[model samples]
Structures are given as C-alpha cells and as structure tokens.
Target: MKTVEQLLQAKGHKVISIAPEKSVFDAMQSMAEYNTGALLVMRDDELVGILTERDFSRKSYLLNKPVKDIQVKEIMTRHVAYVGLNDTNENCMALITELRIRHLPVIDKDKVIGILSIGDLVKDVISEHQFVIEQLERYIYDTPEI
Candidate 1:
C-alpha cells in the first residue's frame, strides 16, 4: 500500500513545465531536452493545463497547423485530473484508467508537487507483484518440516 507521497520521494518530485504563452515548438524542444512525454502548462505559478505528444499529433499534425506559430495554450488539455500527495497509488491508477489518461499531476494546496505516468504506476505494480511472488515461493518451498 504505497502512497503517492512515498513514490514521489523515491522518484524525486521535480516536474518539467512550460508557460502557457510559449510556442508549441518551444514545448516540443523542452520535452525533447527533458526526455519527457508531457509538460505541465503553467501560468504565473499556477497549473493551467498539460501539453503532450498526443496533443501535437492529433491537433497540430493531423489538422495541418504550424507548430512553431501555435501556442501551447491552444492545444494543451485544460481539463486535467490530479491527485494529492496523501492519495494511495491505487487511487492514482484508478483515475488514470477511468480518465483514459497517461499522466497525472500531484497537487498540494493548489501547488504542483509532482507528476505520475502510467509507466511509473505499471513499473511499481510489477515490482510489488514480483516481490510478493518471490515471498510466496520462498514460503512454499523453503519451509522446514511444517
């Protein structure tokens, strides 16, 4: 039953963000430099929206828009789903699955604390399952004359 706070602490809470007024090209450049799939859209220290590769592909590329000229605020997803630090990983997973979203921002009193991705949740779940399986195998095979 690991908490989001614990996961954040383990993974580091730093998140890459960009201003809403920045160009889509700038967002892409920042994403490339950070090697991240998404960027938090911020305005005056407030989380405004989120820009992801999917947004670019679907909105800009498919629509034949100029990425260099378009602003991030134009294509970013403004309606975001978020979790808090005290929330359980289970809640995070549920929100991701229910919303069909890949990333979720962790908030604390209107402040962005961290970000979580589907990959991160999957990795953590797999690791925990592996540990449980190993423990079960050890108990079943290593018990002495029970």
Candidate 2:
C-alpha cells in the first residue's frame, strides 16, 4: 500500500523535462544522461507530452527519420496518463498496464512533481512482498507446537 509520496521520498523527486520544440536528439541525450527510459515534454512548465525510447525506436529508427530534424512533439505521446502524490503503487501499475505505457507523470495541483516508471512500481511491490514473507516465516517458526 505504498504511496507515490513514499516512492518519491525514497528516490528523490527529480523530474527531467525538455521543451516540446527541442529536437529528438536532445531528448535522447537527456534520457541517456539521466539513465531513464523516458523524458517529460514540457512547454513553459506545462506538461505537453512524454518522449520515450519506444517513440524513438518506432518513429526515428523504424521510420528512418533523422533525430536532428524531428522534434520531440512529433513523436511524443500527447495524451499522457498521470498519477498523483497520494496515488497508490497499485493504481499506478494498473494504469500503466491498461495504457501499455512504461512511464507515468506524477502531478500535484496541475504541476508536475515527479515521474514514475513501471520499473519503480515493480521494485516497490517486490520489496513489500519480500518483507511480508519474511515476517510470516518468522511468525510461523516462533509459534509453539500445537
């Protein structure tokens, strides 16, 4: 039952965004530098879209479009699915699965706060399950013979 706030607190809330007018090449470079799979496309602090590696592969490589010539807005997903700080990891996972998207932008009062990746949600769920299993094992072993 971890919240997006918990995840952001565990992993500092740092959002990497690029201007919509920027070239795809620039967005790719930023993704590399951040070691992230996606980057938020912003225009004057507004969440316009999201540019991801998949977009690059599908639009740039497969289509043989030059990254330098194409803008992020050209390939980014305009209708982005988002989560809020109070949202649960389960909710995030469900949205990601339903949308078949790997990233979700976290917003607060119409302002972009953080970005959550499928990887992040998976990692959190795994860790929570592990903790619960360990607790169960300890309880079972510590119980007296009946």
Candidate 3:
C-alpha cells in the first residue's frame, strides 16, 4: 500500500500558508494565485487553522460578516483535521470521507509537511489501479501455457 509520504514525494511537498491575522480577502487572493481550494492558516510558523471556500460561504452566513470585514482567524476552521506521513492512502481516504472534509494537513512530529485533498487521493488511486491493470495484462501476455 502507498503511504502519505510516498504521495507527498511524488506530488512534491509544497505548502502555501497565510497568516491568521490576514483578512479573508487575503486568503482568497492567495488561494486564487496558488490555484488551490484551501490555505493553511499560520500563526508564527505554526498551523492554527484551515481556510477553504466552504468556510467562506458558511462562516460568512453564520457570522453575518462582509468578506472585507472578516479575518481568516474568524472564519477559518479552527479544529483542523490532519494525517501523518506513515498513514496509508486508504486511511486518508477513509478519514476524509468520515470527516466530510476536502483538505487534510500532513504532519510529522508537529511539523507541517504537506497537505492532501480529496482530489489528490482520487488521482493517486486511479493511477495506481491503472498501473496494476497494465501489469496484469503484461503478465498474462508473457505467460506461456500457464
């Protein structure tokens, strides 16, 4: 089974984060520039929360705050979910499904390594399945009078 560390290595451990004191507007701009759906909320190099499009829509509605008036610290999800480097891809998929969350931070010894999305897991699973199918086909073709 593939591990989260393998996935991070394959995908590159690049994380884009924003300060907690930043405005929601700033978070959205960073998300746009990075072409990502979420950003890790950082407070002095420590991850404090996560900001996503869902947070913007739901939190704004509940808080009745304008986008410009809102800060990421106000709207970002404070109880962030995370995964570990040693976790299996299947485990991460299950966690995302159970949590109904799109993004999960990857951490090791309290150090942030990377982030994984539902999309990332899906792509990796599909690619792995494709590779297995190809290998099986090659085995059957190469076998003689099995």
- In candidate 2, the residue pairs with backbone N, CA or C atoms under 3 Å apart (3 or more residues apart, or in different chains) clash, namely none
Worst 10 residues of 2 by lDDT: 58-67
TM-score between candidate 3 and the true structure: 0.94
**lDDT per residue (tens digit) for residues 26-121 in model 3:** 889998999999999988769999999999878877777677778889888999989999999999999999999999999999989999999999
lDDT of 3 at 64: 77
Q: Candidate 2's residue-wise lDDT over 19-90, tens digit each?
A: 998999999899999899999999988999999999888877655667898888888889999999999999
Q: lDDT tens digits, residues 1-146, model 1?
A: 68999889888899999998999999999999999999999987799999999998888765466888899988999998999989888998999999888999999998998999988888889989999999999998899984
What lDDT is reached at residue 118 by model 1? Answer: 88
Task: Give the per-residue Cα lDDT of candidate 2 at 123.
Answer: 94
1 or 3, which is superior by lDDT? Answer: 3
TM-score of 2: 0.94
The TM-scores of all predictions, comma-separated, are: 0.94, 0.94, 0.94
RMSD of 1: 1.3
